[model samples]
Target: MEIDPSEVQSLYRTLAGAVVPRPIAWVSTRSEDGVDNLAPYSFFNVVSVAPPVVMFAPVDGQDGLKDTPANIRETDEFVVNVVTEPLAEAMNQTSATLPHGESEFDHAGLDRAESTTVDAPRVAKTPVAFECSLYEMIDIGASTMVLGEVEWVHVDDSVTTDDKLDVEKIDAVGRLSGSLYATTDDRFSLERPP
Candidate 1:
C-alpha cells in the first residue's frame, strides 16, 4: 500500500506498525520551574556508541514544544529510564498529556531519585537509567529528534552478567503499534561472524 504523507493518521499508524517492537525510552525531565516531567517515546535508540549517545523523537501536535522537548530546551538535560514489564502500567500512566508544570512522577505514583550528574530526576524503580545532556537536535518534518550524550549510567547489579546487563534479568518492554506492547522474554541469540 502506498502511504500518503498528507494522510498523517494513516502515515503514523503504518509507519509505527511496520516498525515492530520499538524500544521505549522513558524520558524524565524538569521544567524551569523545577516541576518534574516524565513520558515515554518509542522512537528512541542508541544512535552512537563511541561517545555514548541516544535519541528520541517527539512528534509535534498542532501546538509545538510538548513538555519533554520544552523542558530539555530550558534545562538541557534528561534521564532515560529503561521500562521493564513490571513498570509497564506505571510507565503508560505517565504518557498522559498533563498541564504544563504538572509532574507525571506524582501522577503515576512513581518515586524520583536524584541523579549524580544531571539535575533531572531518574525513576527510582527503573533497573537502568541513563543520565544525559543534550548533545544535538535534528528537525525532521514535524518531529524533532533529540540526541543526548550519556553522561552516566545506572544499572542494577542484579541484572548484570559479567560486564553486561542480562536481557532476561532486565526484562525490558517494547512498544508496538497502537496500544500493543512486547517484552524481552521472547529472545534468542546468534553468534556474530568475525
Candidate 2:
C-alpha cells in the first residue's frame, strides 16, 4: 500500500508503527522549583560515540511543552535511565501526565540517586543511567530533539561482561507501536562486511 505524508490520517501512528522496536529513553530531569520529573520517550538513540552523546525527541503535548523538555531548557541537565524488563512497569507508570510541580519519581514509587556531574537525579533502581548535560535542543516539526553529552555513566556490574555492558544481562525493553513493547531476549549477531 502506498502512503503519502500529507494524505495519511494519523502520521504519527504510521511513522511510529513503521519504526519498529525503538529504544526507550526513560529520561529524568529536575525542574527549577526542585520537582523531579521522569518520562519515557521511545524516539531516542545515540547521536555520537567519541564524546558520548545521546538524543531523545519529546513532542509537544496539547498543553504545549512537556515537563521533560521544559525542565531541560531551564536547568540544562538530565539523566537517561535504561529501562530493563524488571523496571518496565515502573517506567510505564511515569508516562502519566502530572502537575508541573509534582514528582514522577514519587508517582512511580521509585528512588532517586544523586548525580555527580549534574543536579538531575537518576533512577536509583535502573541498572544503567547516563548523567548528561544539554548539548543542544532543536525544534523538529512538532518535536524537540534534545541532544545531551554524557558526563557520567552508572552501570551495575550485573549487566557487564569484561567491564563492558552485556546486552543479555541488561535485558532492556524496546517500544513498539501503541501499547506494545519488546525485549532484547531474541537477538542474533551477524559479522559486518569488511
TM-scores for every predicted model: 0.95, 0.97
True lDDT of residue 127, candidate 1: 94
What tens-digit string does per-residue lDDT give for candidate 2 at 1-194?
Answer: 88788876658887899898999999999989999999999999999998899999999888778999999999999999999999999999999987778899999899999999999999998999999999999999889999999999999999999999988888999999999999999989999999
- Model 1 Cα displacement at 18 (Å)? 0.8
- What tens digits encode model 1's per-residue C-alpha lDDT throughout 1-194? 66667766547878799898999999999888989999999999999999999999999767887889889988999999999999999999999988777899999999999999999999999999999999998889889899999999999898999979887788999999999999989778899999
Residue 75 in model 1: lDDT: 93
Model 2, residue 18: displacement in angstroms?
1.2
Q: How many pairs collide in each candidate, listed in order?
A: 0, 0
Give the local distance difference test score of model 2: 0.94
Off by over 4 Å in 1: 4-10
Rate residue 93 of model 2 by lDDT: 96
lDDT of 1: 0.93
